[model samples]
Target: MAPAITTLAAAPELSAANTGFMLICSALVMLMTPALAFFYGGMVRVKSTLNMLMMSFISLGIVTILWVLYGFSLAFGADSGSIIGWSSDYVGLSGIGVTELWDGYTIPVYVFAVFQLMFAILTPALISGALADRVKFTAWALFIALWVTVVYFPVAHWVWGSGGWLFEMGVIDFAGGTAVHINAGAAALGVILVIGKRVGFKKDPMRPHSLPLVMLGAGLLWFGWFGFNAGSWLGNDDGVGAVMFVNTQVATAAAMLAWLAYEKIRHGSFTTLGAASGAVAGLVAITPAGGSVSPLGAIAVGAIAGLVCAMAVGLKYKFGYDDSLDVIGVHLVGGVIGSLLVGFFATGGVQSDAKGLFYGGGLEQLGKQAIGVFAVLAYSLVASAILALIIDKTMGMRVSEDDEVSGIDQVEHAETAYDFSGAGGGASSRSTAAPAPAVTETKKVDA
Candidate 1:
C-alpha cells in the first residue's frame, strides 16, 4: 500500500465580481462631490454661486494628492497606538502589489485604496457648505489640506482601523456616521464660529437663486448615495449588502415624506427645497446604521432624523452662527440620530452579532454608541476651531468685506455661474433680483 500525498488549501484569490462592483461604486461616490457642488451652488445667492461650486470641486484635487502621498497610510496602515496608524508599505501607495488583497478581503488593495480615497476627498468638501459665501478660496483650499491631515485621517483610523480605540471597544459604524458626517459637521460649526457671520446674516433676503438647480443637484445626490451606502458592505457575498441597499432606499423615502409632512404643518407648504433637503437628511441618517438595522428600523431612523434635523436647522439662526447652507443642521444632527439609533434599532442578524436595546441587548450598546458619538463630536469641534483660529491669525479665512458684498465669484474666480450681459440686448450684466412692479394708470371700467 502506498500513502497518498496531501496538499494545503490555497489562499484566497481575487474576486472579479466584487472588484467590478466596487469600481462602479467608487465612481458613483466620486460623482457625489460634483453633485454637492450643484446642490450648494443653487442654494446661495447668484453672486456667490460660482464660489460655492468651486469649494467642493477643489477638494477633488487637494485630497487626492494628499491621499496618494500619506493620507492612506495614516488611515489604514498598521496601528502604532490606539490613537493612530502608520506603515511603510502604504506610503505613496507604492509599496503594495496590484494583486494583493486588502486584509483578506475579496478585492485588491488598489481597489480598496481608491474606494477609500473617494471618501477622504468628499469629507472635507462637506464643510465647504458651511463656509459658503464668505471664505477666501485660497484660505478654504488651505484649510481643506490641513483639516484632512490633522482631523479626518486620525478620526477615520479611530472608527474603521483594526486597532483603533473605538473599533477595539466594539463600537460599530457601518459606514461613516462618525467619520464622515459628524466629523465634517462639527468642523463646519467650529470654523463658522471663528470666521463670524455672513455680511448680512439677519437682514438679507438670501433666497436660493435657482430652485431648479437645487432640485437637479439633490436628485443626483440621491442616486449617488445608493453607492455610498450599499458599497460600504464591500460585497453582497452574504446578502448583507442587498439588505443595506433596501434599507437605504426605505429610509430615504421615509425621511423625504416625513420632512414634507412637517414642513406642510409648520410652514404651510411642501417646497421643492424641502423635498431635496429631506432626502439628503435621510441619506445621512442611514449611512452608519443601514447595514445593522432592518428596512422597518430604517424608516424609524429616517423619520426621526428628518423631524429632528428639520428642527435643528433653525438652531443656527437662533444661536447666531451663519451656517450658510445647513451643513450643521442636516449632517451633524442626522449623524448623531443615526449613530445613536443603532443602539436601539440594531437587530443582531445583519452585520454582526451585536443587538440593540429593543432586541433585548440592553443599554450596553447604547452606552458604547454614545461614547463613539460624543468622542468624535468633541474632538472634531475643538480641533477644527483651533485650526481655523490659526489660519485666521496668519493669513485670514474670510474674503475682504468688499469682495464678499460685490460677489465672491468675480473677485475670487473671475467668472460667474451665469452671464446675463446679452439678455434684453443689454451689454451690461443685470442683477438677478426681481424688479419692482411697473407703474400703470388706472383705467375706468364697468364696476
Candidate 2:
C-alpha cells in the first residue's frame, strides 16, 4: 500500500479519522481472502470444492503467523541493500509504542501493520487457484510459509519499502500490481510447472459447479477492492484516495461489459462466468493504475484487461498447462496490463509528476515500469519454482492419482463441502441421463 508523502517540517499527530478509515479498510481487505475462497471453491468440481476453499483459507493462517514473526519487518522495516529490510524492534512487533504513528502518516504503526498484514495474507492465497485439484495440503501449506518469506517479502520490499530500488527509482505501483498480482501469478506459474497438471488435465469436463457462488464471490471482491485501492493512500486528506475509489468502480464496470462483449462475439454467448471473470480482470488491472489514471483512463485499462484476459484464460488449453482456475490469465496478465498501462495513462496530477507516454512523458516511465514488472516476475517465478521443488523433494507435493481422481476433500480433509446422504434420494442422487449405446466407431473430438 502507498503511504501519503509528506513535507511537513513538524511531527505528525494521529488523526482519528484516518485511523478509523484505515481500520475499516484493513477489515475490508481481510474479507477478500474468504471471498477468494468462495470464488475458487465454486469453480471446481464438487469432489474438490472443499480442497479449493482450504487452499485459499490456509494462507490466512500461515501468512498471518509469518507476518507477525518476521514478514512485516522484512517487508516494511528499514531497508538493506535495496533488497530486503529488517529491524530488531519489529520482531514479534515488540518495540513500537501503541500510539506511535507510522512514518509520515497519521495512522498508528499498529494500524498500518495490520492493514498491510491483510495484503500479505491475500497475495499468497492468489496462487492457490492455479494449483487446484492437485497439491498436497501439507505441502501447499509449507509452500505458502516458504514462498512468502522468500518471494513475497523481498518483492514487496522492492516495490513499496522505504529504500526499495523500485521505490527510489520512482517506479509507480499505486498498490500491488507487481508486488501482489504479478508476484502471485508468476509464482503460480512456477509451482504449477513443478507439480505438473491435474490427473484429468484437458480430458474431464471441469466447468464450475456453482455459478451463483462464483458471482457472489466476485461481488464481494468488487466491494472489498474499494478499500484495497483507496486505502493504499492511507488517508483521505487529499483527493487521490477519492480518485482511486472512483477509478476502481469505473474500471471494474468497464471490464465486466468488455468481457461480456468479447464473450458474445468469440463464443456466441454471454456467460455469467464471463461477467464475473471480466469484473475481476478489471479489478486486477486497475489496482496499480487507479491512483495514477483518470476514470477514463481506468476504463481503457479495464476494457483492455477484460478482453485480453477473456482470451488469456484459454491459453492453458493451448499451451498444455492445467491452471485449474485461470489465476495466471487474470491476475498475471491483468497485473502486467495495469502496470504497463500506467506508463501510458498516468495523468501526473494524482499520485506523482512522472507522466506516461500519452501525457508526453515519452519512454522514460514506461521503461521504469517494465523493469519493476519483469524484476518481480522473474524473481517470483524462479524463486517459487525452487520452493515448490524443495517441498516436492521432501514431503511430496501432489496426492496420489487415485486419491485425486476419487476426491481430495475426502482424501486430505476427511470431509466434504456438501453432503446429500440425508436428502432422501434427491436430484443429485437420481440419474437423469439415458444409458449410452455401445460405441460403434471411434471419433476425434475437439473441445
- Pairs of residues clashing in candidate 1: none
- Our tally of clashes for model 1 stands at 0
Q: How do the residues 286-383 of candidate 2 rate in per-residue lDDT, one tens digit apiece? A: 99999999899999999999999999999999999888899999999999999999999998999988899999999999999999999999999999
Predictions in order: lDDT: 0.92, 0.93
Q: After superposition, how far is residue 32 of candidate 1 from its true place, in Å?
A: 0.4
| Candidate 1 off by > 4 Å | 1-10, 424-447
Consecutive 10-residue window with the lowest summed lDDT within model 2: 424-433
TM-score, one value per model: 0.93, 0.93
Off by over 4 Å in 2: 1-8, 424-447
Deviation (Å) of 143 in candidate 1: 0.4
- Per-residue error at 332 for model 1, in Å? 0.2
Per-residue CA lDDT of model 1 for 1-447, tens digit only, reads 899989987887899999999999999999999999999999999999999999999999999999999999999999978888898888999999989998868899899989888999889999999998899999999999999999999999999988999999888888899999999999999999999999989898889999999999999988888888889878768899899889889998999999999999999999999999999999999999998899999999999998998889899879999999999999999999999999999999999989999999999898999999999999999999999999999999998899999999999999998876556734333455567899999989998
